[model samples]
Target chain A: MHGLPANLEEALLGLVREKLFEGGATLTVETDLFAAGLDSMGIMQLMISIEERFGVRVPESAVTRDHFSTASSLAAMVRRCAAPA
Target chain B: MKALSDSIVEAIFARAAEAPERAAFVGRDGEISFDHLVADVERWATVIARLPGFPAEGVARIGVRCPDGVQHTVLMLAVMRAGGCAVPVAGELPGDERSMLARTTALHGVLSQGGEERAADGSERHEIGGGLRWERLAAEEPCFPVEDFESVCPAFIRFSSGTTGASKGVVLSHGTLRERLDSANRRLGIGGTDRVLWTLPMAHHFAVSILLYLREGATVVLPEGSLAGDLLTAACQYGATVFYGSPFQAALLAAEASERDWPGLRLAVSTAAPLAPETAGAFVRRYGVRLSQGFGIIEAGLPLLSTTGEDPMVVGRPDDFELRLEGSGTEGGLCLRGPGMFDAYLSPWCPRQEVMADGWFHTGDLARWEADGSIRLVGRLKSVINVGGSKCFPEEIEEVLRCHEGVVDARVRGEEHARWGMLPVAEILPVDGSSPPTDGELSAHCRARLAGYKIPVRYQMVRELPRTASGKVRRV
Candidate 1:
């Protein structure tokens, strides 16, 4: 699974906007996933976005942190997944 | 901090060396032989041992994010072989959950594919605790061999779905690894010539049988896409004989196949959760495949083909473990014991005495023995939703609703109610393209199927029920 990093980031942002936020416009790097009302089930929608965006496997354990904590952490994790090893 | 036992990794190597040319792995990318796979593991093993922070001694637990396909198995086996425990992951979790489990476990190292553009220290090492990636670990490289290794050591730790709390790590013995592996192999009827579709996630023990597949020279089909279509397509494409899943996975597969036909399937083995009698019956009716539901957990070795008789609720008899019962009512806890079972949970281990009274590990499942000695699981004792002490089991309600003609799936979770304290609520998926059954119709249907108290007080119809990757309905 290979793809562009910027496109991956933009795709992730678009996903948070469309699937997560409904383009309501409040999502940012500092947004609190839990406090913002993104429950575990809602986090699953984010799981799909990361998978679709970077084409990498994010384990269920990852569901607890890095991705769901904040927008910046989520983006960094995604960028890591999208970044070529 | 390395919590796993040692023999698990040795078994992986033993299985690989036994079948060098056999199909060790199958992913969307392609197939690989056990011989080539071992070379890569050894190369990484050598690299891991010398890294500054990597554990060269003591019981060390490591996390690895393996994709749906490719040879993440190689990296894991290498770790175990080098006397390290392999913390298997779903490889599809979000970053936060991934980091949480990593930090919770404090994995010494991490192995991931396609994550890092460059290493933090410019070294090839990838930290497993956080999403620290290195540019070199993903390539096709051989793992270097460790000159000195501890054969008698912990391999990895697994999370147990606790009866009353969030899941905790369960420790297995490298001491009993071989015995456990053998029991699973015997039950699975696995061999080198038999190709296994690695449908279960990497963290599960059944993947230990992957070694058996290699020994027999059989190919493995590792699906890269969604597990939704992978099993069916692989059943036809790989001629999968022993299809494995939890009762829910079996039910979903049967439900999915209800609309189609699957002729290539040979054996349908259900574990993790008890397959409902109706779920089993439907699969046999549609595909003519008998659903083999059994019981398993991280602490105890998963036994095979346990059932009192032909009933799906009858989880057969324990092959490698022991069983016992406590309490009464339509619900009670099912306890188990045997050699392959772990002695106790590492943390606190306080509940050990209660759970291990009389050499049996109380499984906390509401079950009973039938006339023929088969175990019947009603549901989890703790999973009950308390509505002002009018105790209710969600599975019973969901089971009745799932039987509705227009309902393909249903989930019953307890929701906050001002007056009731907690009330049973449901979410449902209609059968095929038809409209979901009306709430009144469903409530009436449940009235006939369950006690008046068990009837759902509220419900909503939707395109699909929320489920985990393994197909179990998620409560929260």
Candidate 2:
């Protein structure tokens, strides 16, 4: 499966791990971030962090259940929004 | 001054007759004029009157599933006009949960928006105007003996947002509801010239805010969405006079980089949750309008309102209610006896006399009366966690976690945090010796169904959680 680019995924996962899972919780591409303790506020913070890191503004309309479902999903959203149109 | 009609339906009709062209509610669809509202309410009332088993003897309790919109307001009024008690059901509830609510309330019928009406019996569904669907379900089951809502002059029934215990329906009579509106408007002074910018869910604050605004001939403005930009655009475009929102919304508005000021906005009242000092200050700094904190409870309508933004910690003085502390000190259980107090609890059927002691309703909130007569809320007697001012009961989160396939058992608790007042943390036992699901998976499961504040911030795999002798998860 064509998932997020390896480097981008690593960077996103690193941020997720540091901000969301401070207790060294392991994560996978298919892992559900919400069930892993990433809440709505955490999602907002993650969006802000992503915006600052990738220079991509996550529009409010794009903030839905699908966009932040998993690590892979979030990475995909960032890639899609950050890509040159 | 002539005595105002005790019934909200009568008052609406009077207002419609007085000024037919006045806008009662303004939404994305368009403004619903009082004349149109009354006409539409009457049309829906006629449809409801023809429905079978619509309580031939007493007031029928009908469940309304319409979310925050113009149609919801119309449907609620129509239900009341049809001489039935309107019970608002959250549209986001799962099918099973909705059915549970229906059974719990022993509803005569259910009016939903844009969905096929589920029926256990061969009841036919009718398409009502204003994007509403109705079904008569009372005939399928024997009706439970409900209190005579008409006798008590009740206008609506709202369920408590409590997640820990069984949800109890708070019955507010028409008289009490009107009194609440009057008392709140005494402080707010909303008039024909005032246009309120609304953000909170309609189901939660309809009686205290929306109905009150409509009764006073003020216009209610519905934002496109909860986004800070959407709210700002609506407020500025519509010339919103008053902006009512929660602390979360305030924080979002504060965070947005847009350097715009809503010149028409006069007052911004925050309720339905606590207002954080930082959020209040940041919103004032951003919008150049002080965020006034209002202390409102379901049992007792808005009794205290902070008019001046002098102290963020103080929730202002009580206007129409008598407040007393159970124990002497700076802090104690905040108890109040108010004009718009709830008439009764539906399930288990506790009358006001039984629930209230010595004419005072003990608000579970722990608060301190300052030397200056201002009250500051300290904590809650109940184990409800306040996440960034939003109350989330751990029991609800624990119940949601237990529903996960990989979870065998779960216990949720609130951990005191610096930013958000409290953050919900969960400990889970994996099923069948399987590895516990990653935090991402659990949060995804929760975020899909539950509200944002209810989602846990931390999760840990544990063999067992501390429990009392009766096997209740010990919150303390």
Residue runs of model 2 more than 4 Å from their true location after superposition: A1-85, B1-5, B115-124, B138-144, B148-150, B160-166, B387-392, B400-408, B417-420, B431-434, B437-455
Would you give the TM-score of chain B in model 1? 0.67
lDDT of 2 by residue, B1-476 (tens): 11235568777677667778988878675888988988888888777777766766677778787767788888898888877789887654545456666777778888888645362234457776666677667553423345444568667888746422545777888877877787888877888888998887676678878788888788888877656767888888888999887776777677764668888988888876667788888888877889988887777778888878767667888767889887877799888887877887766677788788587888888889977788888877877776654566777788889899999888887777644466778888888556679877887677654655566766889887788899877776
Off by over 4 Å in 1: A1-85, B1-6, B92-100, B115-152, B204-218, B255-264, B307-309, B327-331, B349-358, B383-476
Candidate 2: deviation at residue B363, Å?
Answer: 1.3
C-alpha lDDT of all candidate models, in order: 0.57, 0.73
| Position B200, candidate 2: lDDT | 75
TM-scores of the models, in the order given: 0.61, 0.81
Docking class of 2: incorrect
**lDDT at position B176, candidate 1:** 54
| Clash number for each model | 55, 15
Q: Over the stretch B1-476, how does candidate 1's per-residue lDDT look in tens digits?
A: 23323455545566677767766766565777777877776777666565556655564556666554445667666677666766665443434335445555555656666543221122255353323242222221112111211232445556523344434555555665566666766666666666666565554443344544553455677654333344567666766666666544455466552255667666677665445577678668867878776566566665646532267667776656666678654346887766565533434333344456676676666787777666777666566564432345677677778888998888887776432335677888888656667765775566544434445656777776678889888765
Interface RMSD (Å), every candidate = 15.7, 8.7
